[model samples]
Target: MSKILVTGANGQLGQCIKELSVSLDPDNTYLFKSSKDLDITNYQQVLAAFTLENFDFCINCAAYTNVDKAESDTQNAVNVNSTGAQNLATACNQTNTTLLHISTDFVFDGTKNSPYIETDKTAALSVYGNTKNVGETEIIKKAPKSYIIRTSWLYSEYGHNFMKTMIRFGSEKDSLSVINDQTGTPTYAKDLAEVLIKIIQNKPIPYGIYHYSNEGTATWFDFAKAIFEITKSTIQLHPIATEAYPLPAKRPKYSVLNSSKIKTALQLEIPAWRDSLKKAINALP
Candidate 1:
């Protein structure tokens, strides 16, 4: 039997991979590792993991996703995002294994009004974005055959995401403020997990950059409202502009991605946003 390795096995996306794997292969062997078992920042450890597993492929789910924190802790973010990605890319190249690297919409400055194409010029807005972009360049240059899928607004049952946060705050309070100026497509980890598995199994050399998210766009306020409605909570949402919702790191106001190329090229039928949302919400608890 073949094996697939996944890093960040404890994160939201990693958990989704585990759940999706169980359904895809009842007895499939998964070499899931957290930062403890193997830290990508350490080259020798990554090499050792590659040698020990000798798996056919790897899906890198680990990332420094703390946007604001990353602004101050740029070194930490670069260490993991850039250097670590370099380690993984180099290891994959040497081991003759494929890699599926996860990316974010933050690679763009979010200035465009229309959905961002995969080939759009990348202009990072924050330290987190810059580091992630560096990681992407390293991986692409080292492992040309790897698949780099850029997603946005990720959420799941296990992690503290926007949806979960809103649900918790909404149930406990009567009102809240969300940045309505920031618009993006909400991506469910479960859906991305499925897509990853398919790409790995098929191994078609359509290998390049791709954008994937749910089929629709919404602001943080809209997303929060959706969560409240689903959970049956009456949390009044105050629409706030991005200026009013300042943070240490600047976020893209509009980062809606164009996933049509991936869909057509991969022959994928993406699930509707609401349908995926309901499944993710129901999976909680």
Candidate 2:
């Protein structure tokens, strides 16, 4: 059985992995570490953990996800997303452990209308994106046996996410405004969790960057509408332009990921955004 070390255990993706571990891959051993338990930004700390445990794989889920806050809190974002990734990659390299790092679609500037392939040029528009892009680069440079999976619009039953926010707002208010200009896919973290586990189970896994998200394209308005529909809420949702609402960080106008490469590599079929959304909503407590 492979011994896996999953960083950022308290995060949504990490929690999803932990939830799935019970029935998905019961034989494997898993060690879940939160940011407090282990900080990836510290090279010595990371190396010490690697040295202590003979980990078969290190799933690095630790990341500073606040997009707007990242603009002002640049150093913290860099320390966690960039330097933290560098430390993890270096330690994973030294320990001969395969690394699976999670990344974002924000790496793209949202200029391209078409779905972004793994080979597309990353022109990050915000500090968060730039740092994450740097993290991907560091992983590639340091770890040979690594898989960087870039996903978009990630949400689930756990944690603070778009879905949960919509649910709360719909309950509290009668009307809500959402951005229609920005387009992407809503990926259920549970679906992503399954894919990650499947990749681990699938022998002779391909080691490189890959894109995984639910099928179909959607704007934020479309996503919110779907959420209200699934939850049977009558909240009047208005579709607004990106310019209508101003934020510290600039978002990609379009960041739809072409998941064909990952599908072909893993021989897997991904679910549609709405289908997975229904599942996620139903799974919510």
Q: For model 2, give the 10-residue run with minimal summed lDDT.
A: 197-206
Off by over 4 Å in 2: none
Query: Could you tell me how far off, in angstroms, the CA of residue 238 lies in candidate 1 after the best superposition?
Result: 1.2
Tens digit of per-residue lDDT, candidate 1, span 1-285 = 668899988889999899888888655578899989889899999999999877777899989889999999989999999999999999999998888999999999999999999999999999999999999999999997698999999999987798888878977998999889899989899999988887766547487899999899999888887888788888787999989867999999899999998898778999877778888889889
* Error in Å for residue 80 of model 2: 0.5
Per-candidate Cα lDDT values, in order, are 0.89, 0.96
- lDDT (Cα, tens digit) per residue for candidate 2, span 158-226: 998999999999899999999999999999999999999988889767799999999999999999999
* lDDT (C-alpha) at residue 144 in model 2: 96
Q: For candidate 2, report its TM-score.
A: 0.99
Error of 1 at 1 (Å): 4.1
Candidate 1: residue 76 lDDT (0-100)? 94
Judge candidate 1 at residue 6 and give its lDDT: 96
